[model samples]
Target: MKGYYQGFLIRDWQECDRNNAANILHSVLTEYGLPWLPTGADKDVIKVEEFYLATGGEFWVVEKQGKVVGTAAYYPVKRGEKAVEIRKMYLLPEARGQGLGKYLLTELEKTIENKGFREIWIETASVLKEAVKLYESSGYQAASGVETPRCDRIYVKYLPLE
Candidate 1:
């Protein structure tokens, strides 16, 4: 994945991006008063590619002159699952409003669709109303079954795989 907006570069996650990914995840969690070292977050940030590649998934980061400013990833519910879940996507305050979120999401969606996934899901806290709207505007619909204490809402999107 390669994308740039106003000098911010979007690319695949590498081992060296570990600290940056963890920092971005930590910053978002702290900003929202959420736990910064939850089990899921810990595992993903430290070993992003390891977590995703095993399930044919991918993690990406947006960097400003080599410093990570945004993060996103999608992984299968199971190794051979038909659908995948989007996780830990965030952009720093300085990175928002530049359409980077939408741009990153578009690339992520294309990645899953290209990988032959028929559906994708994402969940978020009710407090993040902007995130909810972003998901809704991007062809995702309200979905149920996700009951994480960290999030109160789930949204899903279907793709036409060719």
Candidate 2:
């Protein structure tokens, strides 16, 4: 389902959105001194819907007048797992501070929660203090054990009980 929030539009990713989504992902990551593209990055960009759709997952983009300004995605951390990991939750500088990050995350969390995911996991570099703040502000707790050297921090949020 596509949605409009403030002046931006949020929609399920389309094949045509590959470059726009990739550019946003590349620019945001590198701005924090992180690499532009991770291994197999193109698979997510080029086959976004294909990669996530069959697995009870989703990838979305926020666009302003047809240009991607932000992106967020969720995929199963592993087969038959109750936990889902968030990825690419980045917004351009122009789109920051307007509650867009929270908006994207809130939407994803709700969708995943409804899908019976017990918890959501997020990984981020310690250098991105603002991102850590945002995730913590949204009820994520610092989880022990780094999932990878690529990101030094991991956060987890258990879904609410029924």
Q: Which candidate is the best by TM-score?
A: 1
Clashing pairs in 1: none
Model 1 segments more than 4 A misplaced: 78-81
Residue-wise C-alpha lDDT for candidate 2, range 29-73, written one tens digit per residue: 788897764455435666676667777788888988877899889
Alpha-carbon lDDT, every model: 0.82, 0.82
TM-score of each: 0.90, 0.89
Q: For every candidate structure, what is the RMSD over all alpha carbons to the true structure, in angstroms?
A: 2.0, 2.1
Let me know the TM-score candidate 1 reaches against the reference structure: 0.90
After superposition on all CA atoms, how large is the RMSD of candidate 1? 2.0
Predicted structure 2: lDDT: 0.82
